[model samples]
Target: MDPENAASPPAGITREDLFERVWTTPINHLAEKLGMNHYQFARICEALNVPRPPAGYWQKKAVGKEAPRPELPAALPGDHARWSKGTRLLAPLPKRVYRRVERKAADRPQRPARHPMLIGVDESFRKTRTDEKNEFLRPYKYLLPDIVASADHLSTALDIANEIYNALDLKGHRVMFAPADQEMRRRHVDEQEVPRKDRKYGRYQTGSIWSPRRPTVTYVGSIPVGLVLTEMTERVTMRYLDGSYVREDSKLVRSARPWQLTHSWTTEQDLPCGRFRFVAYCPLANIEWSASWQETDAAGLKSLVPSIVARLHGSEAELQALIDAEEKAAAKRRKEWAEAQERYRRQEDRRAVEQALSHSKKQLAEIMEQWAAATAVERFFVEAEKRLEHLGEDRREHIQSRLALARAMLGEQDPLSYLADWLAPDERYQTRYPDH
Candidate 1:
């Protein structure tokens, strides 16, 4: 047998061993030993089924010094050179690429905190005519509308006042309304306590018109807090003489006795008969009228009062219902939005897992391609060594030098030692390819 061909202990090697040895050495150092660029050596390491370490890892190890040449293992038989798809390897990755992947993974949304509450309020009203007639025998009318109209106006005003009150109350403040007239003030006093009254008695006024000697009655109405007062007045002129043609001045006749009815009195003054005043007194809180009340004027005022109250109640109820419905809708939308956010968070977690798996697979494929190419070059070195052993001593030295040159060109270490280096043990390689 040829001495060069003589069998040494066949290198005890497995694919896992080859992968670990090749993977453990830093790529830059391996490149220096093979007289190749770092990237070129990286391709060789990849062919040997080694995964790349991050670039920073090698750079730190080099510490600004020239990278050292890596040692190769002893040669093994061709049979020991088997490669498998599942072979594990360590490969060096570019620092930029690794950082980019890490950043992408971290760019997801985080959970959110709670927010504050939102609220709103609004008001509305309508007008209507009253049934009573005025002193001129014409239908009694409001400057705008009648009792229902006043009630509608009052209801709208109260609604607005209530909204302001609610807002102030939330902020620890108070609100109150005083009436424009006595009837409204009376109503207000009846609704609230004496201490709760916004204004003093006799501060507001109520007025009515009627035919002389006609029976009249007035109704005392209730008032609410926060009422704003405004003034109103009317005047009329009566002409008893005519001056159309002759410009004549007419004289009025004077009666010898202008008879006026008077109530009788005995030893002590007696009360007026069949004529009485109806006064509504509230002990809880007193209400003052700007104008005095007469017994003959009561009937007309009393007749209009109930309509005003009814209109106010209806309008208020409707407005309150509208506000309630709006609030309910707003609350419902908030709840739904919260649920949607939770679902979105869960979806993001699932996507992260899938992305990680895909990234790992892509990295593995790149390492495998590099390792396959390096293996082919190593086999060529093994063949050349066999042919070199057959030459004469002088020619053998020449051939050996040529073989050395060839190894350098192929970026290989000693063929025998390189094979042994490819079969070293590595824990990381074993873990990634446990089944192998």
Candidate 2:
């Protein structure tokens, strides 16, 4: 909220009157007169081509170092020079949508103690870094502990992180990087007091998500707790004009009026309150556990590390219970998997045995069919020999000679050979599940 633009009028002040009032009185007081908020009044001034005083104007004026006020320019051909009392502004965001609790104030610690891990990490962080939000510096190095803070607040945030790390160290809770051999996972911890909709839920943030090559965790007894330190961001109201939302003090890229471009919007950046938040979580997969502590205006985070550590120590029993449950669940799953494998094996073996039996029966049936056919051939030869006894002597001799030729022409069939070639069920398939 701009302090120069204050309580508006019931009849809606004219462009000339609005411009004079904006420079003369604070917007907060003027807005209250019209029963309007500071944001609505500020937008009204922009819509009417009335420029409000920049931030720190009132503060400077009090000290007699105020800058010169610019003359209100005549409206462009399409610009609005007058506003009605019930002037329509863009719809506001719901109260529930962006309601963030204000974080407590933080006071810096002088010559704050440094952790062993962060001793040389400062130089490394500076070696590889990127700009964030035109204000914050994000270091890409993951060897450093996960700490998210603007360049201005980096020293303070690091001091808080360092003190906490060493305090845990002294208590025998060793704050260190996760071992390479361990297949641990780190969860993204958001410290900004931004709404869910405004936040960018990306994997790569200012060391908030997958920034750590290895998770930074501390052992509270047998339970491992993943830790992250972040400088919390306060919700700042930004005006949207010329296709971007920026601070009131920032220059516009393009001269876009409220009617020409879109309306104002809010941002999740800090008008930077130096609040810090510390988060601890379970890094193990499928285990849902986390705890957080935020600095208050009354007490700084550096002074509370000992108490926070004690709370973390107290949380051990709860974490242990979750671990025990996970172990028991894993054992049950293993047992079930083994039983399923064994059951499938038995089913396959029984199927093989049944197939073998069926195959042997088919072979026996085929052999019996061949044996019956062979018997008929033998019967025919035996009957023909008996008939030879009734023929005349010469006829019998000729017939018997012809019959011998016919018998030789038709190959002799052996009935016993069919039975000898047939196999039993055991020869067809060997069964593993003999009981079945």
Which candidate leads the pack in lDDT? 2
Q: What is the lDDT of residue 299 in candidate 1?
A: 51
User: Using Cα atoms with residue i matched to residue i, what is each candidate's TM-score against the true structure?
Assistant: 0.24, 0.53
Which 10-residue window of candidate 1 scores lowest in summed lDDT?
114-123
**Candidate 2, position 217, lDDT:** 82
The RMSD of every model to the true structure, in order and in angstroms, is 42.3, 29.9
- Give me the displacement of residue 399 in model 1, in angstroms: 3.9
Q: List, residue by residue over 370-416, the lDDT tens digit for candidate 2.
A: 98888887898899899999989999999889878987887778878
Please report the TM-score between candidate 1 and the true structure: 0.24
lDDT of 2: 0.71
> Could you give candidate 1's per-residue lDDT for residues 1-436 as a string of tens digits?
2222222224433445444544456555544544558775454444443455554655666675434434444322111243333333222222211112334456686322111110111111221223221111112322211111123133332333333233433432222211111223232112111123232211011222211111111212222222211111112122222221111121221211223112211121111112121122221123222221122344532333343233433343444454456567767878888999866755664555445556555555554555566667777777777887787789989878887887777664333443333322331122232332
Which ranges in model 1 have alpha carbons more than 4 Å from their true place? Answer: 1-328, 406-436
Q: Which runs of model 2 end up more than 4 angstroms from their true locations?
A: 1-110, 126-140, 149-153, 190-208, 231-274, 285-287, 296-300, 358-430
